[model samples]
Target: MIASSARLARAAGGSRNWLLGVLRGSSYGTASEASFQVESYKLHKLEQGPSTSVTLSRDDGLKMYRQMQTVRRMETMAGNLYKSKIIRGFCHLYSGQEAVCVGMENAMTPDDSVITAYRAHGWTFMRGVSVQGVLSELTGRVSGCAKGKGGSMHMYGHNFYGGNGIVGAQVPLGAGIAFASKYRGEEAICVTLYGDGAANQGQLYETFNMAKLWNLPCIFVCENNGYGMGTSVDRASASTAYYTRGDYVPGLWIDGMDVLAMREGTRFAKDYALKNGPILIEAVTYRYSGHSMSDPGTSYRPRSEIQEVREKRDPITNFRERLLSSGLATEEELKKIDTEVRKEVETAAEKAKTDQELPLEELYNNIYVDPPQGMKIRGCDPTIMASTR
Candidate 1:
């Protein structure tokens, strides 16, 4: 390039020619550097951790961007479905927390298991459950992961424990799973997730002690999504450092909005837990929607807060920017991905609408492994009890 510039300068008789040479060589783009050049994007509010190397190659960047977009689109559709009365019971949309689930899932191996509390739509999708099944579950259709039984709070998959409803209840169950994995001499690590609200529960600390004592391979993920239901973390908890909530257990705090960072943090935690027992991850993230369908998300928090996060820290947008900056993809390509994801989610919803709801007998059968002669439980309607005689 320099030699060519010199020859052009001589041919054009000086500075005017040199300027032309430079202008011709440089492409008009946001970044002056080569499109494929890797750039450093800083992690936000990472309070603590031993850092891990992240190579956001073109394939990885685009893939993660696509996954996060899918989760966001899925949650948006779920919210719409809920407002339309298609999704009944309690429904918690995991819109802004897409990075946490997608990153964690990416870091997980086939043997690694996962269990989280109610906000579990994204996790269920990542665990090999089809989008159709997830939507069907939300729509209370039999095609759901649990055949319409679990709904949003109880979908299950291979090596995935559940969408447990009770607060902090899944923690010990996760420990039990890790223990079982150890007993079988399997190298599986269990990732147990709960919210900041559940962080204050005594059961979590109890499980932490047992897990540390037994040296179980467990990654206790505290998804600190700013609020515990209607109350902010500061309003609810005495201390907000969820990572350190498990006293003796080592903890790492990461910017949960960054998918690459989340993936690296989870990977480290999983590896550390396998040999050194339990570790905790306080993934600082935010949720775009209300705690559930019952709560209007804007009451406790200002709408501006959500808007700011959406504009500035949106995981999907941030990842997309990285891809564009690195020349991994053009703006058109990313938009195309978004367009495809939105359509895919919409199609799943359409298909889910046609699924058959579980019959009333299903209520009585799943409750007991062996149905007694006089088994009776509340059917589809609580006012009318159905008998399994």
Candidate 2:
């Protein structure tokens, strides 16, 4: 009956009714307006913070929910393929941190830039790469965004730098990108994300200094996901209050698990960074999977703790409940979206699994954007000189 209603709605004209008239299944449509009480941003060295309350329209709610759900499902599929050994080498799943990327991306414009660490599947998708693109990249297929070469931690999108493999490498690179934007006098800002593990890197502090010195428009985000490579944040850093770690730069501590909170905080930070200089944001999130595909993620932390977070603070589930309670959506509507997401992800997974990888002759093809004419690059062995495609 629900499927029939969906088909009927689609057949009618694929309007808003396609989402509402059928999925709503009610005389009165879902609430047109809703206000949610998101967690307040904890400020440091700043006079004001983002509002504790945020207004949500059905459109925004549905989009945010769907994006987060797609990321979660896609990451799950990546994990499954990795376990089966199809996706080899350096597979990092961003399962429990969906809200961070989804919320941040929704607040960003295409003109804005983003760069982040290796756990970048979610960010890659948020930046416009499809699930198929990300999965195929992981599987080293010809159809990947990087054309099967970059692999898991090197995927790129427009205005998105990379899935940088080095622990603290992307931070300074992001600063440079912001500097370039300022140099060109473009009204753009760059959001550079790193994990709690990278918090202690000296290069980050050096980049922070340079960013502030030049007044570059950069938002440095630390996704403090409690544990870093099996070690707790407490063990990783002497001072875990990452927001305050940037002594001169202003900071905001945010509830990373809450999508609304993340959105508001990022929106606020983006504006502040453009007007003033760089700002620091510590998004306190959690990760359900191991640091990489190789670790089981159980020896260091208790399974019960993971269960607790899933039960009490799972981002997707919490957002779904909020949508229902606030009348932004109905259970049936959300369920329909979930069903569609699963099917989309499953279809993408199948293609990624079966897609063809780049052939051998194409090697060293993208060595340089504009290589000199007749440039023959060295191949695997010095004896083998390869011509540029």
Candidate 3:
């Protein structure tokens, strides 16, 4: 009877009745039949294979989930600190876009380098900089990754080049790193990340041409978070498809909020670049905080929009759900991780607040490896000679 009804509905121009009946039968019908239908759907999707979910192992999923959670909590702590005026200077938080860094870092080896714009706390954390080091940097203390000189916008770790201040300037630097890696005959690749706002910079194209001309092993990533500072990507660039900005580089666009998809896409890009030269990946992610903690974050965008993204598509929440559904992790386990991460962030912030600021004289210390001849020495300048002239 159900088959006859489905046939009649299909005969009627593939109407809604056919779709509804199919769904009903699949859900409320025989278990065996439902299983068969699911298998058929999976096979069909595999054959089509345009947009599909990327498979992830339980260990990979859990690791990505933990990294993302750590970033989320760390950003949340920074926002609170900024509110209290504990952390000052241009601070860009990467709260809503954890998966991009976590996934890409997972695809990279320890020797591979990464450089990004001011929105870099996430990358720093993923690159093995302790939360304490990042918080200390924000607080301008001696314990920071840059020893308090490079504040929130310039933290670095071993192999992680920088949190560059110039908008799209890191592209060429990343290319340079890649050039060095290739010169040394190393298999390492450099991943340079930039914002949608920086995508319009003419230098990016120059770097792209050079990278391609030399067949450099570099992965140029554009984190298309919709807005660059106060300007939406649409307003800033005629061509908003940032991945395609590098016309010479093959491009891949992944759902940035989906950890599995990000991991799979980044892995594919890294491998392809290793073999076929450079590649570009555009991860469509979002940032929840203001471009920095100073901006109210509502002047250019709607609160409703941020709320929608958070409630519906939060990367951490999405990954948590997938893990639970797949039995890779339990809700209790995830909650414990969340609690521990929050506590760790809070402790780091407290330590950062009390850590001593860099000495005023240290400012002139690292200016040069050795002082230039006849260079005017300033107060406490380490360049001052100890000899009696």
lDDT against the true structure, per candidate, is: 0.78, 0.85, 0.75
Q: Candidate 3 has which clashing residue pairs, if any?
A: none
Greater lDDT among 2 and 3 belongs to 2
Best by lDDT: 2
Model 2 weakest 10-residue run by lDDT: 8-17
Q: Kindly report which residue pairs in candidate 1 clash with one another.
A: none
Task: Estimate candidate 2's alpha-carbon lDDT, on a 0 to 1 scale.
Answer: 0.85
**Candidate 3 local lDDT, 1-389, one digit each (tens):** 23211211111111111211121122111211110010001111012211233445555666778889889888888888888898887889998899889978887889899999999999998999999999999889888888888988898998999899998999999999999999999998999999998898999999999999998999898898989889998788898777677886677776677565576677777777787788887888899878877678899999999997887677787566545544455677778878888889889998899999988877766655556665655553533543211
**Candidate 3 residue runs with Cα over 4 Å from true position:** 1-53, 370-389
Residue runs of model 2 more than 4 Å from their true location after superposition = 1-29, 372-374, 379-389
Best-fitting candidate, scored by TM-score: 2
- Residue 225 of model 1 has an lDDT of 90
Worst 10 residues of 3 by lDDT: 34-43
Question: RMSD per prediction, one decimal?
Answer: 9.4, 7.9, 8.4
**Where's the lowest-lDDT run of ten residues in candidate 1?**
12-21
